[model samples]
Structures are given as structure tokens and as C-alpha cells.
Target: MCTLTLAWQVFEDAPVAVAANRDEALDRPAGPPDVYRASPLVIAPHDVEAGGTWIGVNEHGVFAGITNRWTERDLAGERSRGLLVADVLETTSAADAAAHVERTTSEHEYEGFNLVVADAEDAIHLGWDGSLSRTAFDPGVHVVVNVGFDETFALPAERRDLGERQAESARAVREALEPRDDERVEGWLERAGTVLGDHEYGVCIHGDGYGTRSSSLLAVGERTRYEFADGPPCRTAYEPVGIEGQF
Candidate 1:
């Protein structure tokens, strides 16, 4: 299981932030970010065999990522989540991408998952549990977990207000990037720690057994950057690695 977070500047020309963690069998051969000929854009370490990605961006100013929802069975065989992300980035506008994913992947049998996609024009969130549901994003801060719920799940009073705090902190970072201020950038970076402080597995072994196995933060601008960590209060950017092939 994994976690994916995004922060977007409400008043900037095209400022966006993203963070994610790629959780697999732990023994899978994964590469870092690199440019490929088919898509011919920089993509995060993608599992060629699996045909999906944790995060990636194209020169056309499009970005996309995926988070696996904790469910009873594996969904990999039903549809290729990575390919879905890449397809959206390469071919569609953010406004209609979610529907495309839903319509295309509906026939395949899968567990469940959420996808976050963005472009200069719009951003979208999609939740699929063999069925498809989606919501368009307004300019601001938002977070997506593996729970298959929208912002509603983002707040839970019982968690010591952790979810609310994280959401607020994420918004702060987005505001900081509006003017692209260094101080604000630093401040946002610092606050990012607080937002991700309570990182937990997407699936709890003691409970659902699908707790978050990793977390990530990604930002896209003139250039795209990514940071990943095991638990919340996540810090550090990962070096890009290269992957080959295209679907």
C-alpha cells in the first residue's frame, strides 16, 4: 500500500506539488526517473512488467500518479493502474481524464484504488473499486489516501485531529508557493513535516493488513520534483532513476 499527496498554488500561473511512495513486493526491480522514447517524458521509476507508475510528468505540462486502495484481493491483473496514469497524462485533459479511466477500466476486475491527475487546465481525483467514481479538484490543497473516500475521509476527530492538521498544513504549503517565495518555500517544507507526522501503513497488518507501506510528496512546476519516506513527517527527495519501455 502507499500514500500520495498534492499541494497546488491557488494564485500561481502553474504551480503544483506532489508526494508519493511506491510500495511493491519489495523485491521488484524498479528504476528511478528518466526520459523514455514512447512517452518521451520524464517518469518516475515505473514497473515495466506491471505497466504503472508511482509518479510521472510529460513535456506537455501534464502529471499523474496512483495510490492502491486497501482491498480484499489484488487488482493488478484486472487493470494496469500505471498504464492508466500514463495514458491520462499523454492523451487527455485533466477535466475528462477520470471518466476515461473509469470507463476503460470498469470491465476489468480489480480490488480498488485512487488516482490523482493534473495539468495546466485542471486536476482530478478518481476512485475505482471495480466501479468508478470521481471528483474534480478546485484550486487549493488536497490529499488522497487508499481508503477510497474523498475529502470526507481526510478528517477524523478520533485521530487526535491529525487528519485536519495535515490538511491545513498542506494548504499552508500551497499558499507559500503562490508567490514562489523562498521563505515560504522553506516554511512549507518545514510544515510538510508536521502534516505527514503520523504516517501509517495504508493497510494495518493488525487490522486490515493493507496499511500504507510508503508515502511521497511531489511538486511540479518548470521542473518536477519528488520526495518519499516510510512514515509521516516525510522528508527528503529521492534521486531519479531510469526505466525503459512504453505501453
Candidate 2:
């Protein structure tokens, strides 16, 4: 996931709502949302090149997503960060998942990343840029980009400058996004799709052989609801995925 907007504990019925866009190279192969794990019923799209996912959710109502944190140089991580998202999803609850991520990431090596793991009970943001840090934030609307919007971390001058330049596109999108009229998470997802697709906000990118590739909307409450757009949200329509009421 390149950019993620989460409305945690903002709705009356649904405690979590998310609108996320995955930006990647055009040639990178990927599949739409599907059943990846059977026991707990994990739903996520596959990064065909890496055999992992950028975002996913489980039957336990746990949601996990990752966004790359821009660095001065483009370097491949020893391990794909998306796999970390998958690992955290295996846990039953958000807090447990978060603790697992903290321990695992501290022991392993991954490139710069901003990770969000959350369920109705807990929401945690973990940022890594050669170092690791964890943050707990209040419930409300939050936007995370490559540089990590609300989840801040110390950085070298060069790296920070690079982030300022590269992360502006995602920040622009967040600024231009309008609030949803209705309170329901389902309604917010529909409204988010409209604005998220608009190039005017820089949410939908048309770059040189690289741009926004896929989108996901999730609402977690008594029952979980998920919808996915296989292609760029601007040109593709979202369809329901997983079991309608659960899973």
C-alpha cells in the first residue's frame, strides 16, 4: 500500500474504516483480493512478484497495511515488508499483532516502512527507517504516506529532504479529500472512492510506467465488509470480496 487513510473509531456502528491505494510499477504483476489463508480466513491481494501482500485483514477483524518510507536511495529490503503485514495478520487481535511486529522487526532487517496494525480494540503505528519505533494514537481520521503523516520519526537531513519532495503527492491527496456525508462506513467507502480516484488531488497517479495500481476499502464492526478495485480506482469499479457478513 502506498497511501492509506484510516478512520478508526469514528463511526457509530463500524469502529474501523479504511481507504487505501497501492501504487507500484505498471509491470509488477498482482492479483485482486482473494482468500490467502484458510483457517482464520485472511483476505488480501497478492504481490505476484514477492509472494506476499501489502494490505490484508483477518476474520478476527484485525487490519494490517504497510507503506514504504521514502529514503534518499532506492534499495531493496532484505525481506519484503509486505510479508510482515501477512505475519501480523496471523495474530488474533490488534494489540497482540502489534507486539509481534515490534519483536520481529527489531530482530530482522527491512527497508524503511510505515506499518499500521489495528482492530477495534487497538491501533498501533510502527515506523522503521533503519531503526524501529512504535506509536499509539487517538481514534479519528489518519492518513499515512511514504514519509508517514501523523506517525513521525527522526531522519537524516538528506533523507528528510528527499521525503519532502517524494511524499508531497500523497500529502496533497489527503489535503484535498472531502469528508463523507453519511456516518456509515459503507457510505464513506463509496465517497472515498470518488475522491480517491480524482487526479486533481494527486491520489490517483499517472506516472511514467508507474502509478496507482489497486485500491481497497474496509469497514470492521460487528461484521466486516471489504471491497476492492482490481485496477486503478479511476477506471475500475469496486466489487465485494470475502464472505459478505463475516470473514
Candidate 3:
């Protein structure tokens, strides 16, 4: 996933709410969100090229998403970062998942990435820009893009030329999201999808060889709901992802 908004422990009923858009090559083959594992109940859209997922949630109420950091260097990892996302879903909690990342990245090399792992009780953000650094959220709304997680989009001057499009996109989305953070209310996830689909913000790109491919909205808690769109949210309709007894 290239762009995402996470509301961790921000709701009375839903402790973990998420909205994300997966940006990728137009020709890249991918399957819609589905149960990939039964043991721990993993549900996510699968990247056919890598057999991994860019985002997902598990029975444990653990949510994971990744955004590739902007860089001129080639992605050198032997393993796809999406696979790491899959491995994390197997973990029981956010802390365990954070440790998994710490240990795994120490032994393996991967492209620059920004990752978020959260549960009802705990949440963490891992920024991997050559080297990995970890952080904890203070319980509220947050935005993450190719530049990594931030309370607000602070476009780096050095990267503006190379990543301004995505950076500006995040800025626009953040502008739309500021109210939710200030008022401390609900429904931000669905509203996030609406803004993501808006062309003005550049969140939904068209006529571009590479752009948003799919979108997802999820609520995790005593009652969990998941919705997904096979194509860009701009023109495609979203369908509910059934997780009947999984969670």
C-alpha cells in the first residue's frame, strides 16, 4: 500500500480503524482480499508477482500496512517487504510483531519502507530507510505515505523533486483529515476513502502507467468490518470482505 490513514485506539467501539490505497504498476496482477491462511485467519489482497500482501489484518486484530520510501537507489532486498507483512500477521500482538521486524530486518536487507503494526492494546510504526527505526503512536489519527508516517505531511525539500507528487498527495489528504484529529470523532475511515478517490488531491491517479490499484477500509474491535475495491476507488465499487467467524 502506498498511502494509508490509521486511527489507533481512537474510537469507542473500534480500536483500530484503517483506510489505504495500494499503488502499483497498472499491469501487475493481484487477487482481491481473501483468506490466505486459516490458522491465524489472514485476510488481504495478494500480489501475484510476489505471493505477498501490501496490507492485511488477522484474527488477532493486528493490522499491518507498508509504504515504500522514496529513493533513487534500487530495491535490493532478496525478499519482498509484503512477505514480512504476512509474517507479522502470524504474530499475536503489535509488540510481538514489532520485535519480529527488529529481528528480521537485522539479518535481512530490504528496500526503504514505512510500516505500521497495531492491535487494540498497542501500536508501533517502523521506518526502514536503509536502516530501520521504530516509534509508538500516542493514540490518534495518523498519515503515512512514501515518505513514511507523520502526524502531518512535512515534505522534505531534498525529496520534493523526486517525490513531490506523492508528498503533495499526502498533504492534501492530511488537510482533509485534520478535522477528524481535532474533533476526535468517528467515520474518518470512510471519509478517507472518499478523499482518496478525489482526483484533485492526486490520491487517485489516471493516465499514469503506475497508480492506485485498490483500496480498503477496515474497523477492528468487538465488531470488525472490512471493505475492498478491486480497482481504484475513484471509479470502482467497493465490496464487503466477509470474515464471518475468523475474528
Local lDDT at 87 for model 2: 90
Best-fitting candidate, measured by TM-score?
3
Consecutive 10-residue window with the lowest summed lDDT within model 3: 178-187
lDDT of 2 by residue, 1-247 (tens): 3778888888877787889889899999998888878878898889889888999899888999998886554545788898888898788998998888779876887888888988888888888877777888678777787877653533456667645644565556555543456557777778788767877656677789998999998888787888999888999998888667545
Clash total of candidate 3: 0
Model 1 regions more than 4 Å off:
11-14, 37-42, 72-76, 154-217, 225-237, 240-247
TM-score of each: 0.67, 0.89, 0.90
User: How do these models rank on TM-score, best leading?
Assistant: 3, 2, 1
CA error at residue 217 for candidate 1, angstroms: 4.4
The predicted structure with the larger TM-score, 1 or 3, is 3
Question: Each candidate's lDDT (Cα)?
Answer: 0.54, 0.79, 0.81
Per residue, candidate 3 scores C-alpha lDDT tens digits across 81-179 of 989999998999999999999999988888878889999998898987567788898787777888656643334567775466776677677778654
Candidate 1: residue 57 Cα off by (Å): 1.1
TM-score of 2: 0.89
Winning model by lDDT = 3
| Superior by lDDT: candidate 1 or candidate 2 | 2
Candidate 3 pairs with clashing backbones: none
